[model samples]
Target: MNIALPALVVFALLLPGFIARSRIKRAERSSLDYSPFGQIVTEAVLWAGGLHLLWLALAALFFGRHVQPTLLLGLMVSDAAAQARSISNLASELSWIAAYFGSLFAFAYGAPALIRAAIIRWRLDRAGAPLSPLLRFHAAPWYYLLTGADFPPGEEPDCIVVSAIVNISGRPWIYMGILDDFFLDPEGRLDRMVLEKVMRRPLDADKQPSTQADEELARFYVVDGDYFVLRYAETVTLNVEYIKLRPAA
Candidate 1:
């Protein structure tokens, strides 16, 4: 019974973290890399020590004068010695239960906020810029690309930006205007983009204004005056050459 109780307590204490790790692994697939061995060892020690201290504090609070550190110390000593005592009679059992459930509850409540904070910190670290409110829920790769740090001169951009050629259903069309907004899938890939002040010109039309033409298009050619949503999957190609043109005086 003593062996069983301590084993159960240990499992309960670690279960929340184990479940979190599993969920992160599943979510990130192989993209998540393992920490260094030294860092892993350090974190393991810190977690074990912190949990043990928390358990001790709970024991002192619950069992008070009856709580004996010797019982807990022996429980940690060896399997044989741990099995020697009857866990049911131990004054600290209630404290163990409280600590176990308390840890689980804390993790459940705080994990989402913690994850958000971590992601924000990581994005800031990688992009070397403050995170935009627009990207609070988006992921790293998207943030990096949007910040223009990932794009260099003469290179194909990772994302479709201001003005571009958007091929939809094999029909080539010129898309003009600001890329005002975008959405990301759970895995952080761009799902859809919203363009504002949008105008479209057929690829074969010679009357089309030069990309640098700042004059407003005739109302007839304006596809969407306010906004248009372009799905990433539906877009066959995006030519960013127009983005290099200087606006007409």
Candidate 2:
């Protein structure tokens, strides 16, 4: 009985850690070349500590006191009958506690993830929002992970284009330009982006264009007259990878 209870506890503690390690492995499968030893150890320690605390809390709350330490000591030194009795009692107590608190833990982890997934789905499904083909897959959620200052609704700040990679005519092209303005459809969804004073780098480019070398391509493309209109649909992939509002000079 003592051996069984300790084994159960050990299994419970390690299950979460194992699941976490599997998820990390899946996420880093493409880019990471080396084993993440530090991350693995950190996650294992964190899961073990968190589960221990949960178990302790459940025991204290339901049983009116902590019992594992005493039970473990008894198991180690007690006689056969005494050890058997202690193990049976401890197993019975933990079974009830695990049944109740395990459900609570599952709900706590699941609810938030479901809520966030719903929110991201709603935003992406809205009409006129910039749609990416990648959004049809698991990568959709990554679109919301934009790095920028928080711009509240109905407030248009002076947004500057730092750099952009645009796929045009079945070929990838990089452009360096200044963001002038943006247009939204009737539903207040982003429709078109206008970039002014644009300079196009060479086709099939892998590296960022040198601003000094491309001085000739630097010319003002007037808004509503000659500015580049990115309609969001014409490209295979569009990433606003970086943006910084150029301060007024």
- Among all candidates shown, the one with the greatest TM-score: 1
Candidate 2's C-alpha runs over 4 A off are 1-8, 17-35, 58-65, 70-87, 104-146, 149-173, 176-249
Model 1 weakest lDDT span, ten residues long = 21-30
lDDT of 2 at 39: 60
Task: Give the alpha carbon lDDT tens digit for every residue of 154-197 in model 2.
Answer: 32244455345567666766565556665545433455667776
Error of 2 at 23 (Å): 8.1
lDDT (10s digit) by residue, model 1, range 1-249: 244656775666555544444332212223443556675455444554554566557656876733466665556555664645634346546775566567654654466456655654454333224554433332345555544433333442433455556676777776765677777776556787788767777666645455544553542267746788877776656533224444489
- How does each model score on TM-score? 0.52, 0.40
lDDT of each: 0.54, 0.51
The true-versus-predicted C-alpha distance at residue 207 of model 2, in Å, is 16
Pairs of colliding residues, candidate 2: none
